[model samples]
Target chain A: MRRVVITGAGTINALGRDVATTLEAMREGRCGISDLKMRDLERLAIRIGGQVHDYVPEDRWNRQQIALYDRFTQFALIAAEEAIQQSGLSFTGKLAARSGVVLGTAGGGLSTSDENYRTVYEEGKNRVHPFIVPKLMNNAAASHVSMEHNLKGPTFTVATACASSNHAMGQAFHMIRSGMSDVMLTGGSEAMLCFGGLKAWEGLRVMSKDACRPFSLNRNGMVQGEGAAMFVFEDYDHAKARGAEILAEVIGFAMTSDAADIVMPSKQGAARAIQGAMTDAQLNSDDVGYINAHGTGTAANDKTECAAVADVFGHHADDLMISSTKSMHGHLIGGTGAVELLACIMALRDGVIAPTIGYEEPDPECALDVVPNEARDAKVDVVLSNAFAFGGLNAVLALRKFA
Target chain B: MTVRDKVIAIIAEQAVLEPSDVTGDSSLEDLGIDSMGLVESIFAIEEAFDISVPFNANDPSESDFDISSVDAIVAAVEKLKAEQA
Candidate 1:
C-alpha cells in the first residue's frame, strides 16, 4: 500500500478568512462565536452563530451560477482554490487525470431552500426559481469543486453529519493507499448559519445559549459554525518524486458506526475508531502526542469523547494534549473534522498545540490535559483527529510528521 | 380600513418594504420577498388574524385561495377567518 501525505491545506472559518489567520487566532486562544447579525434573526430564540462575515462571491461566477451555488459550495471553491495553489501541484502534468475530489457536507445549499420556501410561501407564487434543485443538493459542492479544477477521478460528497469531513479524509487516504488515485482534493464545507438552519437545530435543542465552552462545567450546548477546509492529498512517493512540499503523512484512518442512537454519542464507537486507526497505523497509544477532540461543548459529546480517549490511551490519556478547536471555531458540523484535521497537521509540523478555548471548570468526566485556554509549545510527532456525528458515526484519522 | 389595506400593510411589514411599494398586482419577487420571508409573513398573518392559513408552499395553488397579490391575500385571509367563525 502506498503512503498518503497532505501537501497543502486551506480553510475559511469564522475565526479568519484563510488558514494562516485562522490558525493564528486559534493559537492565540481566540473565540469566533459572536452575536448573530444575519437577516431577520433578531426574533429567533438562538441569535448567535459562527458566521463567515468576510466572504463575497468571486467575480468569476456569473449571476446564474451565483444563484445556483450555495454559500457552502462558495466556501469550498475558495478553499479548494487556495489548497490547489498552495500544493504547487500543477494539473498541467499527468496529475490531472489521476486526481480526484471527495467533499463532505451535511446541509448543502440549505440557504437556497430557505430562500425558495419564502418565495413560494409568502408570495403565493407558482413560478419557482429555475436553479432550486441545483442549489439545494448535497453533492453540489463537490461537483462545483470538480468543475472548477477539472479533477477527473472519483468525485463525490460524503454526508456523515459531523463526521462527514473525517470520513471524506479517511476515504481519500484509502484511495491513495490502494493506488486508486494518485492525488485527491478532499475536505468538508458547511454553511448552516442561516435562519432556517438555526431553526432546524433549535428543534434538536442542543444549541448553546452563550459562547461554546467545550468540557467546561458550565458548557450549555454546541454552537453552529460555517466554513470549509480542504487538503491536497497525494501518494508519498508521488509527491516526493515531484518535489512537492509534504505537510504531513496520513498514517492510518478508521470509521465506525454506532448503531446505538440517532442523536446520542457513544464511548464505544469513539474508542473503536481510535483503536482501529492506531491498529491500522501500526502504532501504540503512546505514539499519539495530541488529539483534536470532537468536543461539541455539549454535555453528552464531551463526556463520552473523554471516556473514549481514556479507554483508548489508558494511562497516557492524562499526559496527552487533548483540545477541541470547536471551542474557538464553534462546531462547523459537517466541516468540523476537516478543519480540525488541519489543526492536527499544523500542530504536528509547528510543534505548537492549539488551545481549546473556553475550557473553564472542566467536568471530572472530561478530565484530560485539554491544553486549557492557552496554546502550548511541544514536539508533536503524531496526532489524531476524531469526529463523532449525530447518528453515532465516528471517524478518526492518524497523521504523523513526515520523516 | 378594508381587508385589502390590512393585507397590504401586513405584506409590507413582513417583507420589510414600503406599504406603497406593494401594489395590488405586484409580484412578491418584485417586492424583494423571498421564500423565508414569505414563511415569516405567513406566521405573522396567522398571529395577527388569529386564523390558521391552511396553505403549503409545496402546494400553493391547491385551494381556490391564493395570496399572490394584496387583494388575493386579503380575500384568502377573510375567507379563512369566516370559515373559522
Candidate 2:
C-alpha cells in the first residue's frame, strides 16, 4: 500500500474567506454566529445563524458562470482553486487523467429549488428553469469541480448529513492508498443559510436560540453555517518527487453506521469507529494527542460523543486534548468534518490545539479536557477528527505529522 | 382600520415593497416576492395576528394553497387566525 499525505488545504468559512484567517479565528476562540439578515425573516422565533456575510460572487466567478452554478458549487470551485494552486502539482501531462474530485454536501442547490418552486407555482409557469435540474442535484458540486479543473478520475458526492466530508475524505484516502489515483481533491461545501433552509431547520427544533455552546451546561443547540473546505491528497513518493510541500499524512480512517435510529446518536457506534481507526493505524488509544470532536452543541450529541470518547479511550480521554471547531465556525453540516480535518492537520503540524469557544459551565457528563475557550500549545503527533451525522453515520480520520 | 388595509400593510412590510406597489390582484411574482419572501410574509402575518398558519412553509406541495396575491394571502391569514380563535 502506498502512503498518502495531504499536499495542500483550503477553506472558506464564517470566520474568514481562506484557511489562514479561519485558523487564526479558531485559535482566538471567535464565535461567528450572529443574527441572520436576509431581506425577510423578521418574525421567525430563531433569528441567529452563522451566515457568510458580504460574499460577492463577482469576486470569484463571472456573472454567466455564477448564474449557472449554485452557491454550494461556487464555494467548492473557489476552495478547489485555492487548494490546486497551493498543491503546486501541474496537471499538464498524464497526471490530468489520473486525478479525481470528490465533494460532500447536504443541501445542494436548495436555494435553486426554492427559487424555481416559487417561479412555477406562484407565477403559474408551466416549465421550470433550464438550469434547475443541474443546479439542484446532489452531485452538482462534484460535477462542477471536475468540469472546472478537468479531472477525469473517480468523481462523486457523499451525502451523509454532517459526516459527509469525513466520509468523502476517507474514501479519497483509501483510493490513493490503493494506487487507484495519484492525485485527488476531496472536501465538502454547503450553502443552506437561505431563508427556506432556515425554515426547514426550524422544524427540526434543534437550532440554538443563542450562539452554540458546545459542552456547556447551558448549551441550547447547533447553529447553522455555510462554507467549503478542500484538501489535495497525493501519494507520498509522488509528492516528494515533485518537491510538493506535504501538509500531513493520513494515517488511518474508519466509518460506521449506528443503524438504530435516524437522529439519535449511539456511543457504541462512535466507539466502534474510533476503535476501527486505531486498529487500521496499528496505534493504541494513548497514541492520539488531540481529537477534533463532532460536538454539535446539541444536548444529546455532546453527551453521546463524550461518552463515546470515554469508552474508547478509557482513562486516556482525560489526558488527551479534545475540542470542537464548530464552537467558532458554527456547524457547517456536510462541510464541518472537512474544515475540522484541517484543524487536526494544523494541530499536528504547528503543535497547537484550537479551543471549543463557547464552553462556559462544564457538564458532568462531558468531563474530558476540551481545551475550553482558549487555544493551548501542545506538541501533537497523532490527531483524530470525528464526525457523526444523522441516520447514525459516523466517520473518523486520523492524521499524523509528516515524517 | 379594515382587515384589508392591515393585510396590505403587512404584505408590504414583509415583502419589502412599497404599500402602493401591492394590489389585491397583483401576483406575488409580479411584486418580486420569492418563496422565502412568501414564507417570511406568512410568518409575519401569523405573529402580527397572534395566530398559527396551517400551511407548511417547508412543504408547499402539501398545502396546495397559494398566497400569490394580496387578497389570497389576506384570506389565508384571516382563515388561519379565525380557526385559531
DockQ in order: 0.02, 0.03
Q: What's the distance in Å from true for residue A295, model 2? A: 0.2
| Cα lDDT of model 2 by residue, B1-85, tens digit | 5667777887787668788888999877777876556667766766778876555443353454557677887787677667778
lDDT of 2 at A87: 94
Where model 2 places Cα greater than 4 Å from the true spot, the runs are B1-85
True contacts kept of each: 0.00, 0.00
Candidate with best lDDT: 1
Q: Candidate 1's residue-wise lDDT over A1-403, tens digit each? A: 9989999888899988788998889889998888887877875677888888756686558887798788998889888988999998767556778898999999988888887888899778888878789888999999988888888889999999999999999999999999999999999999999888898886555677678888887787888999999999999998899898989999999999999887778899999999999999998989999999998987778999999999989999988999998988888999999888878977988888989888779689889999999999999899999999988899999999987
DockQ of 2: 0.03
In model 2 chain A, the worst 10-residue window by lDDT is A37-46
Model 1, residue A84: C-alpha shift (Å) = 0.5
* Per-residue lDDT of model 2, residues A1-403, tens digit only: 9999999888888888888888888777888788888746875767887778888999867878877899898888878888888998767567878899888888888888877877788688999867788888889888888888888889999999999999999999999999999999999999888878888888665777678888887787888898999999998989999889888999899999999888889999999998898888888999999999999898779999999999999989989999988888888888889889878977988888999988889899889999989999999889999999999999999998886
